[model samples]
Every structure is written in structure tokens, then in C-alpha cells.
Target: MSTAMAPEPVDNGGDARTRRSIARAVLANPTMVTFGALAVIILAFSALAPGLFTQGSNFVQLAQNVAILTVVSVGTTFVIITAGVDLSIPSGIVLGQVFAVQALKLLPLGEGTTAFDATANQTTALSVLVAVTAALLGGLIIGLINGVVVAYLRVPPLLATLGTLGAGLGVALILQDGVNSATYALDPVGNGALIAGIPNLIPIALVVVIAGFVLLHLSVFGRHTYAIGSNPEAARRVGINVERHLLKVYVLGGVASGLAGFLSLSYFSTTSIGGFSTANLQAITAVALGGTSLFGGVGSIIGTLIGVWIPAVLKNGFIITGVQPYWQDVAVGFVLIAAVWFDQLRRRSRDRG
Candidate 1:
């Protein structure tokens, strides 16, 4: 019997065309469209409220106001990239503030008693630093629990974080009721300056945002996050330790949340039981608005920063333009819905193509 020669492999010319078509379709997605729309709105508002929105002092306030939100949103970006939702971040932040404040009062200081009279500038500075450290530690511990439950125990992300959310809120409430010193306020200050116009929180927030973006965008840890989020099985099969990477991701998130909490304290100066209830949601919304996929993988810290700023800018502008405070929240809700819708459109177009 004569063996027939093996047929030569056929090269299809359709693959490149299909890819280009898909690329064009994705570019038309709602997320990209809304980002452009939001930019227009910001510019329009800036133009209309030139006196109020474009002022130097208003810019400073904007920076300070959005700082905490930006920090928390960065953490959410990491969690979401892993196809996880961390509802516990707000509670963790609140407790961090509470513990940090408590630590300040209880910790020893130079020639000071357990009860500190924060009247002196030097003592005040030291206390604030101590408070920041305490908050950071609190976030780290909670993050560790979150990572352990999800990674080792194979618990669902929502349930794991939900448990921590309730637990953390309870802890904050306990701190408020037990410590009586929960209402202390921070005084804004300039360091013995003859002439100066700057809010200290603005610098801190800038630093946090830039540093977080760098770590998440430029580091190996960040690359691993994308790898796991995009394909857990493939990442593992390639020798990437998924469990360990997950733990580190959650830990970094916790640290970011802690820093956010400390910053919140600086802005509000008091830790209330009801505080930050909507913060986690807001952070998630910001992350989503910035084009981060809720289904895992794909995200941008720069986009998050812009997303955080837009809402804050709109809110501030609305207040200045005499709109009812309640209307501002309503407007933000509408914008968030539009953004999600856009993201959905993008995903569908990409999938279809």
C-alpha cells in the first residue's frame, strides 16, 4: 500500500483580521466612552465655576478631601484584580484610627504621662506619628486574616471579608465606648512658619498615591497579581506560588487601608462608630470607574486616581454652585451606574470579537 504524503499545514489569513476587528470593537466600549464623558464634565464644571473651583484654596481642599479615598481605592484595586472584593477595608480603617488614637494616649512619651496634653506642638507631632503606626499595624493584622481564610481555607472572598467587616466594626464600636477619648480632634498646623499656606495632609496623600501606584505598576509583586487574576491555574502550572502571592496581595491592601484610616483621622480628627460605612463602597466604585475589571485582571492606578478626583471635584463644585448636598450623592450614583454599564459593553464587545 502506498502511504499518502502528509498534507501541508494550512495557514489561515483570518486571525489578524479578527484581532483587528476585536480591537476596534473593544475601543468602542462604554468604560472608555464614560471616561471621556467624565473628563468633559470636569472641564465644563471647571469652566463654569472658575471663581470657586479654580481657586488655589479649593485645589488644596480637593487634594485633602480625595486623599483618603484615593489611598483606600488603591487597596481595592489590588483585591479586585484578584477577582475579590474586600468589604472589610472601611471597618479596618475605622478601627485603625481608633487604636492609633488610643496608642497615642497610652504610649510613653518624653516627660509625659499616659494621658497626653496634645497642646504642645512637639508632643502633637509625635502622637500623630504613633497613631499612624498603630493604624498601620491594625490593618496588617486584619489583612493577614483575610489572606489566610481565602488562600488556605479556600473560603469565598465575599464571605471571608464580610466576616471581617462585621468583626472590625464591632471592634471600632468597642473602642469608642470603652476609650472615652475617641473624640479627640487634630489641629491643622504649619511648622513655625512666618508665611505659609499649605495643608499637611495634602503632601501625605500625594506621597501615598504616588508610592502605591509605583509598587502596583512597577514591581514583581504587581505582575504576579495580574498573572493570578488573569489565570490562576496557568500561573500555578508555571511554578508561581499562588497562595503566597495572594497573602502578600492582601497584606499590601491592608497596609494601604491602614494608611488611609490614619489620614481620615487627620482630616476628621475623631473616630465615630458610624464613620466609613460608605467608604468601602465608594472606593470600589472608584476602582470600577477607573476601568478595573471586576471579573479579575486589568486595572490602572492612574485611572483610579482620576476616578477618585472626578467625584470629589463634582461634589465640591456642586456644593459651591448651591446644589443640595443630597443631590451630589444622587449624581455620583448615576455616574457610577453609567461607568459600570460602559465596562460591561467593553467586555461584551471584546468577547464577541
Candidate 2:
């Protein structure tokens, strides 16, 4: 003790502070954290279902399966980023598909009486375009009505969309005359393969994602959207037209759903009323999982892209591993819960810092 000086300080506090800083940085960006989670899931599935999960064909199939949902989720992302929810997405999608098919039927292009005739040479490219346009118009009308109800009438988004959800389904059923299925001779968007074995749907979805990213990240409208979601009163005080913006957001959502309907028709060649039973839940779950806070104002399209794939991979993995279909829902439920929990934690940490 007499010969030795006191041991130098270990500086353990400094190291601990550094570690805390790293953790906070990682948590600050939900997209990064979600990507990490997605990577872990992929690795786990690769191990559990080694052959099929990682195969090229399986990847293509996964892309095809998720394309419609991805398109629909884009709209959901827009609505959610503004601190709003649209329960009408599923209905919007179904209505869009049904309307497209009916348009083809009513405006047959050639010698066929029904749009579903394989022998009919009636499906011209122009007819397809017109049918798709009509479907999109229907979606726009529905979205506009929702906007008016929520913005002008001051109804909450949930209740307003909930009413529209039922109305949409009712309208779809009436259009199809309660038919369980309807077919069309529209050209298949999936008939050709692109580079890396990716189908046309992949490119189409990429366009949607890129467009959405630009709209939300690079445009003034995106800024206003964030402002409103972060605080409506404050946004208004700053000269943001909250009602008009909300209306536009809803309408955008509708257009997206309509596009998804077109994609669905291309992929499946038929519109089944029961096929989209879980679509609304899936789109919402994807958006939530992508790290977009339900509370609004903070979100990313890149995150939504990752989120859409998570469920697609999960379902495909489960099916490959012989897991029951119901377990897929269970797994998705857990993912949603975990996402919300992490979101709350991040908010709290931000406040503390």
C-alpha cells in the first residue's frame, strides 16, 4: 500500500454510457430494428425449413402472394401516418376487383357475351384499361365519401371507415349478386418473368413503393401529413389545411386499393368474395409491424415494405414446416403486439432523452 499508488479508475461509467448511447440510437429508428427482426426471422426459417424456404421459386411465390397485400398496405401506411385508420381497405379492394370484372362483362370487347369466356376473343388491351379505370373510379368515390364523412362531418376515422367497410362489402355483394366467385378474361400480369425470376408483379409493386416513398418523403404533402398526425391543433395553427389533407389521404388510399384490385385480378383471374376475408387484418398488421406508430406522425415506406414481407415469409415458412394455418394468425398476432410494445418503449425513451 505504501509503495503502490491508488489503482487508476476503471472508467466503467464511460463504457456504460457508450453502450447506452448505442442502444438508444438503434431504438430511435424503428425501421432498422424491424429489419433486424426480419433478418432474424429469415435466418430462423432458413434453419427450420431449409430447402423450400430459401429456394428461388419459393421467393417468387412469396413475392406474388404479397403483391396485392403490399399494394393495399401502401394506402394503409398513408392513412396511418396521418394518425388515421381505414377499415375500408378490404372492402375497397373487393369492390375494385368486382367492379373491374363487371365492367369487362358489361362492356365486352368482341364476340363474347361473358367476360369469363375462355373461347371469347373479347378482351382487348383497351377494354382491360377501361375496366381497370372504372374500378379505380369506384374506389375513388368510396374514398371521397369516407373523406367527407371523416373530415367535414367530424366523425372519427375508425367509425367512419367501419361503416364504409360494411357498405363496401354490401355493395360488392350486390354487384356480384351475392355470387361467391366471378372470373374475367383479362390478360394475366403474371404471365411473364423478369430478371432474377421475378414476375411482373414485383416490378409493379416496386413502382408503387417507390412512388409512395417519394410522395411521403420528398413532397410537401408528406410534411403536412406528419404535422397533422403529430398534432392536429398545432398543424392547423401553422396553416395546414387538416381537413383537405385528410380528404386527399383517404382518396389516395382508395386509389391504392383499386390498383390492388387490378393486381388481384391479374394474379388470380377470378374475384372471390371470401378470398379477401383476412386482407384488412393483414394490411393493418403489416403496417403496424413495419414500425409505423399507431399514434401517428412517425413512419417509413421502407419499413412498410419490410413489414409486408414478414407475414408473407411467415406464412410460407409455416406452410413449408407443416405448421397449421391458424398458427400463422397466431404468429402475426404476436408480431403486432410486439411491434406496438416496442413502439411504446421507443416513445418513452425519446421522452426521457
Query: Pick by TM-score: which candidate is best?
Result: 2
lDDT of 1 at 21: 73
**Per-residue alpha-carbon lDDT of candidate 1 for residues 272-307, written as tens digits (9 for 90 to 100):** 547788888888888887888888887878768777
**lDDT per residue as tens, model 2, 185-237:** 66555444556677888888889999999999999999888888889999899
Task: Name the TM-score of candidate 1.
Answer: 0.84
**lDDT for model 1, on a 0 to 1 scale?**
0.76
**Which stretches of model 1 miss by more than 4 angstroms?**
1-35, 109-112, 124-126, 178-196
Best by lDDT: 2
lDDT of 1 at 323: 77
Alpha-carbon deviation at 308 in model 1, angstroms: 0.7
